[model samples]
Target: MIGIDMKLETLVNNGPAVIFLCRAETGWPVETVTANIVRFGYSPEDFISGGLRYADIIYPADLEIAVSKFSAYVEKDYRGKDPDCKVEYGEYKGEAGGHKRNAKGNLGKGRGGYDSFTQQYRFLNKSGNVLWVEAEIKVLEEEEGKACLFQVTVFDISRWKHTEKTMPSALDTENELKRIINSGHVIVFLWRAEPGWPVDFVSENISELGYTPEDFTSGSIFYTDIIHPDDLDNVRAEVSKNTEGGRDYFSKEYRILAKSGEVRYVDERTLIRRNEKGEITCYQGILLDITQRKKAEVAQRLNASRLEALVKLDQMAGASLKEITDFAREEAVRLTGSKLGYLAFMDAYESTLVMHSWSDSAMEECSIEDKQFIYPVKSMGLWGEAVRQRKPIITNDYPAPNLLKKGYPKNHVHLIRHLNIPVFDGKRIVAVAGVGNKEENYDESDVRQLTLLMQGMWQLIQRKQLEEALRTYSGELSRANEELRSVNMMKTEFVEEMRFPERAEYGEIMDYETLYAIDSQQQKAVNTFIHYSEKLRRLVDSLLYQSLEKAGKIDYSFEGMQLKDVLSDAFLNNVFLIGEKALEVEKEVPASLPEIRGDREKLTALFTALVDHAIKFTPQGGKLALEVKEGADNVHIVIADSGKGISKELIPYLFDRLYQVNDSVTRRYQGLESGLYICKNIVDAHKGEIWFESEEGLGNLMHVKLPK
Candidate 1:
């Protein structure tokens, strides 16, 4: 406020200096500039219209050197100083010209007023002219504790270049001192180190501390007179010790009593100025009001303490939910400096407030035989207010009639300062936690700590609940897997029993005609038995293959084989079935067809099963055809029959295991329903497709496409 006037527009436009304020970031994007910027042929609109940047006015060749030198000067090591103190980079005298290379081997302009300093830079103004200008830059505003805006003052120094060789006049020194002192964030003062530290010089901005410069400069009021009595002795002792120890500079934080009778925190940084004889003469220093910083520090310490307590509770990983709740309540009571704390969970189903946990330092003082912490939501007092509002409820004066007309119940503990927070699991309020009767009134910081601890405990409980659910699911899955294994074993044993001895019986029947000289009736019965026995054997094979396919244990021994060979073998083997059914067979397999990559046994079995189905379903004298064609990428085979075709609605589920359109007891198919299902599994194993197009009472065409 000292350097920034309410009439800043008028002051900057009329004064010799051109002032600009901009964001403290790369390129120093200009927010506003005085109209006097037009003197350099750049309108204020040029800077404010987002067309030009403050850094653009800096001579391109020297911008990097200027920024690099300022960066080093501003970041000069001040490790022993207070960490919260802002650094002051006053005018530097050392050489500031050198080529500073960036990663791209080019000059780079460093960003922000964090590295801001005063210096002379060459400016490339409009109209093709170069000018010498002195710039004083200071960070004047902050956002969220970060430097955000910079106030830069640029004055034409071309005229001063001629008289620069001469020493400055007293008036020049005084004016320069005034300008620098008023522009800074700190209030500058020079105090003699004798007789209560009489002030020799005080800047006009001393009014910021509710004191006038005249009052100090007149020597009627000593600097120590404004010091808070509690901090006066310690401050005097620290200064005396530093002076005797020959330490030229020292910083200390203390309190001051303002004229309005308010206490303000301040950080004082002093430089011990000495005479030629090496004897201390006076102290020159700056005083910065740091009340907000001190408050922040205290809050930060409280947060750290709260976080430590929460982390300790979290580390109790195996602790029961009740134990965690108890600990959280106790911690809340301790952290908020409350005499008692309690957590009440909202039992939604019962419409009741259930006291899950509580901690009281004065439990023995209660007169009631048993504590009554649970009540219906409608019957609760102040604790229910948090639930009703779905937010926190806080008050230092607790017994106000408007707030609690019912007051405390019989034998309830005395309540004064109180804070209650609604605990949330997602958007719903799950619980209400409250602390009561702290010696000091509860602040927002206390409320925040209590809320954090409660939320953390609830999260731990939720996580444990999820873990329990996961464990239960895992157990159920293990049982289901065991049951599946038992069923698979039963299927395997059943197929084994059905497969053996039947093959031997069929082999014995193959020689029935040679062994027994029998009549036509006996021979026909023997052949019929052989045909039905063979159908039964194919059914058993289908069941075994279906079970294996479902269990993911079906095996395929694959090789590159000729489809023609597989088809020819299948036809020769199943031609007897056609003869038995009195059906005509027409086979058109290409002689030079592209070989399909598949399991030879499975392919042979697949074609044989299709022909067998045709033999069973077709009436006597019905015709069956097997045709194979070669395509560019795959081999297509069609098995057609002039038999009673399948229903259109049943085609979709034709390959489903054990599925049949006619599932009644009177259904007439001889074998089990897994034949087409097994064929589909075999083709799928070979990465092929099997499907059919059919119409009821019309012929059916089954198509198989296998990759070549």
Candidate 2:
């Protein structure tokens, strides 16, 4: 068997025929061919290397006729009942009234059960010499019966063609004309000019679209039935307008539904067939599938849009969180072909969602009366599934009944489709981004695009947060440095004052009266030193507490404590400062005040800070009042001082870290500006509210409300 195979191979290789295999496409791109093809003045490399196609070497004039005949034969043979059918074409007239010699042979099934046909056509060699060849072509089809490749065996027939010329008979000419009308890649249709465009005939190749020609010819399906509903009206209008304008032909592009329920884009070129009276009797048209081309165009546009969106996002450096989120949501809606979108950030614990932004369209279309910014994850609907699942959730059919759906709020924007993706920072789902109401189903492509875009936005968000935090830290550090310099200056002044006493002691004691006067002056200096030392101690303590609080290292021991006792302790601690300032103090405490849950040390510190602030800011003889009373559910404390009150603009920043109203070097107040800020923090830690009401020069009134 091996020897026989070798001999057969040798015979074929030395034969005067060139065998070629090609893709069943428009140009019939060559894949492989026998070495003998070089005898035609062309190397096998030319076709195999994709430099030239089989159609490129076909004689220009005969190319169209050859393709038509070949297509007709393949189509007919493929639809035949016999699996091993043989086709024999009789004599046919050449193009443009030319005559050609008859070339005939049996076209049988090839090695793989594929059908083959024999035909003769003119070809051009490398030197442009015209040669006649008998080409036997075989059609290779996939398992699903779609033709994909062609095998061709060409025999030199120039000698026979030059010796004989034969004219086809009338029957042969009629049959050949019919075959020409029914061939080629396009699906040809003949329709009577009626309401539904009733089909009179359709080419057999229409089966490639998963439909039979007989289905239309038998009136089982109308051309209108196949056209997509969205595109049908436009197609009809185009055809009508052209016909009314007396145009012989017109072209249109529209979508059609194949038998498998897939949407296909087709380019239709229609000719208005008319009778002798020029009245439109029927329409002849061909539909060429352009689905792949349309898809490519859509993909290109989508990619360009995504790139543009990313560029815009990159340009949003230092933008506010709202601005960034709004832009990202809008772009997500546009890119996904959606009508609405939203972006929400998850809390650190991932227990709640804080809505960052909603697309402009969604905000306008939604009519819900209550728009809550923060939502507990457990309270959300299907949109929150991304957070719960820690992955992307897609609902192409939003209206379909789903167990996860908790329904929308009243008058909310209607959802047709929805896609939600969780943005992750490591293992944590930091945010949930979503878009909805796309015209088409949301696929993985949309998921991928949205996920990537949101990830980029998240990175920018993190960067902005870090920048804000750094700015705050820098401001705090600058204030701290200033406070340190002030303390150092005070220390130098204290040292200079001590030298006066030292020099006084060096002088001799003159008399009893003089000695007593000196002793009195020294005592005064000691009191002044004590006052400054206390002020310095308070400054250091405030700085230390602030540092610990910022580091999250402050520990509190919560316990039940008497509100009156806490206030008393705070007053006794600052009694000296009150006496130094000579401010009149008043206290109004209800004996029936209830006990409150708080940290005793922190509570004492909170009150002391407030009292100290009042004393330092109050003028001599100013009144200081402290009052504690019981409310329905809280203990209300009021600390009012008849000092120069805070200005309206400065009151807003009273609790901000390191903020000082009188930040000038020559200001009368002496101490770190963190007393009020620390007081606010301590109150907050005990689950209480603190605020102030004051006007310039009207004395400030501070209010503290703590739950009892």
Candidate 3:
């Protein structure tokens, strides 16, 4: 009453219900409770203080049941059996899983989606007395995929319950009349059976239709005047029968015009009231509002249309982003009844706008030069306002000077009623969509439909991006796999070369050495030739063995073999060299070391390499020790020697192929520096490790671990 600014708040506060908003977590703590809470004999401060919670006021016996039901309801799983609360008979026809037409006939989607539910519970009030209250709750906010707040409207229903219990059986008709007259859902009236059907009495709830009972009784307005003109004849004819005694009662559904110029549907029931003389005196009637039910039917038709459009969009899978954007533009124009629509893409920082797609009824085209000037934010227009404010902008008078500070280009079409909505990627407005020149003013419903269509298109774009990435990764993986296969094939060829043919060649060289020995004149050159040929043969054998190990082509068999036996055999194989050097050999080989699953041939070769390396580097009479021990899951073998140990600078590269620590001209070794590298490969093939620690002048300790 004070000003239009406060009118809405005043009206809601004076309304017949208490409205509240609260957190969605356990116990539903109150965030804001409206002034109307005083109707329940409690101050709004009490709830807002945070000391009291919604669950605390609920009757103790019903608290648990209420919390459970509320949770299920908010989660969209509580399909109650009450006829009025269940999904309507035919509403679920083609709905999807986790989604159904709710009681209000709206298609409910994910958890805590659009839904309405009615609940009745007892509340303990400030007066220390219990009151029966009926509450209507709806999900008001959902954040991070969880319900975060709810809007609740509550009303005291104690009087209605009390009336039902005390009414007598014999006076049922009188009680029924009184109940109907006082009911909030209906308006009861008594009208004199006259020309205008003047009201003699009317229910207090006639004000709900935006008119007072006093207005009808003051003679300035009559009951017939409020009836919609289209429905006046039907209503008059139905009521005449009851008044004229053609029938004692009559019922009809008709439209009524309210004081605010809004048409509402109502079902009317009338009965003629007469004295014992058998003449009609007045008409007794009740009008129940059915406007909400009628509106739901209209919404059902709209939803069906929206569903068809959604299916058509979904069928465009694998479409390019531009194609999807174009389709969305067309749909936006069609649904909102706009004459033209355009999509503008924003740069990463939202600093630039580029017109990406256009749907124009005028079939207008922009020259390449003119397109550059289109809707730049710095120009300061409706389109620019959307980017600057990061919100939607709608203007019926789009051509107004103040709204469009920088006017449109000469070639641009005239915009008479415009709507612009920002398209968001998370919190950033990645694009702005504009539609213009609708015959009627654009409303919130138009914006909602267009925004939903855009969201679906965004999902399609994201899917396309993910699929492209997967294809790229798959191609890279395939190329890498092919390269590995090529390397394995080359190894196979080398392994074949090292087979019977190469060994036979070595045997022929030995035969030549024998021939040279028999010829005494050439005996001097025999040692040199033998040394060169044998070293060449060893190089070829090491290369072939290491290659086979790398390609996983080493055909070694696994069996339970003792570590001590393997080491003993390796030591025995090297007995001649050890005896020639007169090395101090110490054996700590356990007689019964743990048996490991390994290839006997490969294990023997691995230890042989270690022992050979030690003897080659050790000076004569140097100490050599072989030790074997059992471990948690492996057999440990240590071969140590006091040799002219490797230099610190060269130790890291000892296991590298063709890497010689000493100069080739003055080297003491007979073969290439691939021995240690070959040794490492052999150990690795058996799933074992080989490494050595050495000091330049002291000794070297080589450790081997073979898993059991």
lDDT winner: 2
Better of 1 and 3 by lDDT: 1
- lDDT of each candidate versus the true structure: 0.72, 0.76, 0.70
The worst-scoring run of ten residues by lDDT in candidate 1 lies at 78-87
lDDT value for candidate 2?
0.76
Instruction: For candidate 1, report its TM-score.
Output: 0.33
User: What is the C-alpha lDDT profile of model 2 across 1-708, one tens digit per residue?
Assistant: 999999666655655568998887788889998877877998889999999999998999878876666666654333333222223433223321121222332122221222555767789999999998888776644223334677889977775577354533432676775565456678888989998898999988887779998899999999999999999999899989887755567899999998987788999988787675557999988899899899789878988999988888988986776788888888999888899999887654567888877888999999888888888999888888898888899998789998887877789999888999998764556678899988667888899889989988976765564345345445555555555555556555654555344446444523567456555655555555564555555655766786697699999999988989999999999898788778898999998888899999999989888887777768988899988888899999999999888667556556654332342212212224437767888889888999988877988888999999
Q: Give the per-residue lDDT digits (tens) of candidate 3, residues 94-199.
A: 4533345546554543453334677777888878788877887766665544567777788777765575667566446976766656656789889997899999
Better of 1 and 2 by TM-score: 2
Worst 10 residues of 2 by lDDT: 96-105
- Taking all chains together, each candidate's TM-score versus the true structure is 0.33, 0.45, 0.31
Regions of candidate 2 where Cα sits further than 4 Å from its true position: 1-187, 202-249, 257-262, 493-502, 505-708
For TM-score, candidate 2 versus 3, the one ahead is: 2
What are the RMSDs of all candidates, in order?
26.9, 18.6, 30.1
After best superposition, candidate 3 residue 57: deviation in angstroms? 56
Number of the top candidate by TM-score?
2
